[model samples]
Target: MIKLYGMTGSGNCWKPAVLMKQLGQPFEWTEINTLKGETRTPEFLALNANGRVPLLIVNGRKLAESNAMLCYLADGTDYFPADRWQRAKILEWMFFEQYSHEPYIATVRFWVHFMQKQEEWKDKIAEAMKKGHAALGVMEQQLQKTSFLAGARYSIADIALYAYTHVAHEGGYDLNAYPAINDWMKRLEAQPKFEKMTG
Candidate 1:
C-alpha cells in the first residue's frame, strides 16, 4: 500500500491525497504536524533530507515534493495526458504554480491564517498579496481562454494551482474580481471522484 506523510490542512499535502482519491487508489496517511516540528525530527529528516511534509512511501522507496508526487501518480492517467505538447503545457502551469503562485499565495496564507500574523505582519503580507494577485491575474487570463489551466481538459496543472487558490481568501486575497477563476473552480469541483481538502 502507498503511504503518505503530511499535515492535515496543508494544500501542498492535499494535492497528492486528492489525486489518489480521484484515481480510486487507496493509501495510508501518516499525519505530520509541522507546527510541532515533526518534520525536523531526525527520523523524518532521514526519510526526507529537506524536512518537508507530503512525503510518499511507495514500495519502500520514498518520494518528496508534492508536485513530483502528482506527476508520478498521474502518469499515463488522464490527469497527466499523452500528447507531448499537452504534457508540456501541464508542466508549464505546474512550474508556474510552484514559482509564481504558491510562494505568494500559500506563504501569505501560512503567515496570516496559521501564524496569526495578520496585524503583526501587515506590511509583509501586503507586499506578498501584490505578487499573489499578479499570479491570479495570469490564471484569470488563461482561464478566460481555456476551460482548464492547460487547455480544454482538466489536468494536474489545475490540481497544482487549485490547491492554494481555492483557499486564497484565508490569506486575505479577494477573489471576487476573477470571474473566470471562480467559474473554473466550480468546474473543477464538479469532477468525478473529486474530494475536497480537509482541515
Candidate 2:
C-alpha cells in the first residue's frame, strides 16, 4: 500500500492526493500538523530529512517533494504525456509553478490564512501580492491561449497550479480580473472524479 504523510488543506499536500484519487490509486493518509511542529519530530525526520509533509512511501521506499509525487504517480498515464515535446511543455509549467507561482501565491496564502498575519504582515503581504499578481498575469497570458496550462489536454501541470490558484482569495488576491483563469478553473473542476481540497 502507498502511505502518504501530509497536512490537511495544504495545496502542496492536496496535489498528490487529488491526482491519486482521480487516477483511482488507493493510498493511506497520515496527517502531520506542521503548525504543531510535528514535522520536526525525530520520527518524521527519519522518513524525510527535510521534514516536510506530502511524503510518499510506497513499498517502504520514500519520496519527498509534492511535484515529484505527481510525476511518479502520473507516470504511464495520460496526465503525463508520452510525447517528448509535450512532456517538456508540461514540465515547463510545473517548474514555473514551483518557482514563479507557488513561492508568491502559496506563501502569501500561508501567511494570511494559516498564520493569520494579514494585519501584522500587511506591508510584506502587499509586496508579495505584487509578485503574486505578476505570476497570475503570466498564467493568464498562457491560459488565454491554451485551454489548460500545459496545452489542450488536462495534465499534472494544471493540477500543480490549480492547487493554489483556486484558493488564492484567502490570501487577499482578487481573481475577478482574470476571466480566462476563472473559466479555466471551472473547466478543471468539471473534470471527472475531481475533488476539492479539505481542511
Candidate 3:
C-alpha cells in the first residue's frame, strides 16, 4: 500500500488525500505534526530533504510536493485530461495555484488559523488578504464563464485550487463576494467520490 505522510489540517496535504479518495485508491496516512518539529526530525528529513509533510512513499520511493503528487496519481485518470490543449490548460491553473494562489491564501491560513497568530501577524495577514483576494478575483473571472478552471471539464487543476480556496474563509477571505467561485466550488463538491479537506 502507498503511505502518505501529512498533517490533516494542511491544505497542501489535503490535496492528494481528496484526489486519492475520489479516484478510489487506497493508501495509508501517517500524520506529521509540522508545528511540533516532527518534519525536522532526522528520520523525516531522510525521507524528504525539504522537511515537508504530504510526502508520498510508494514502493520505498519518496515523492514530495503536493501538486506534483497529484499529477503523478492523476496521470491517465479521468481527472487528468488526455487532450493536449486541455492538459496544458490544467497545468496552467495548477501553476497559478502554486505561484499566485497558495502563497497568499495558504500562508494566511497557516498564520491566522493554525498558528493562531492573527493578532501577532496582523500586518502580514492584512497584506496576505489583499493578495489572496486578488487571486480569488482571478479565479472568479475564469469561473464566471467556465465551470472549472481548466475549461469545461473537471480536472486536477480544480482540485489543486480547491484545496486551499474552499477553506479560504479560514484565512479570513470572504467567499460570499465571489459568486462564480462559490458556484464552481459547489460543482466540484457534487462530483462523484468527493470528500472534504479534513476527515
Reference-based TM-score of each model: 0.99, 0.99, 0.97
Task: After the best TM-score superposition of candidate 2, give how far the Cα of residue 194 lies from its true spot, in angstroms.
Answer: 0.6
lDDT for each candidate structure: 0.96, 0.94, 0.91
Return the top candidate by lDDT: 1
- Candidate 1 per-residue C-alpha lDDT over 28-110 given as tens digits, one digit per residue, 9 for 90 to 100: 99999999999999999999999998999999999999999999999999999889999999999999999999999999999
Please write out the lDDT profile of model 2 over residues 1-199, one tens digit for every residue.
Answer: 9999999989999999999999999999999999999998999999899999889999999999999899999999999988999999989988999999898999999999999999999999999999999999999999899999988999999999999999999898999999999999999999999998877
Better candidate number, 2 or 3, judged by TM-score = 2
RMSD of each: 0.5, 0.6, 1.0
lDDT of 3 by residue, 1-199 (tens): 9999999889899999999998989999999999999999999999999999899999999999998999999999979968898888889888999999999999998888888999998998998889889999999999988988888889999889999998888878889989999899899999999887873
Q: After superposition, how far is residue 32 of candidate 2 from its true place, in Å?
A: 0.6
Query: Which runs of model 1 end up more than 4 angstroms from their true locations?
Result: none
- TM-score sort, best first: 1, 2, 3
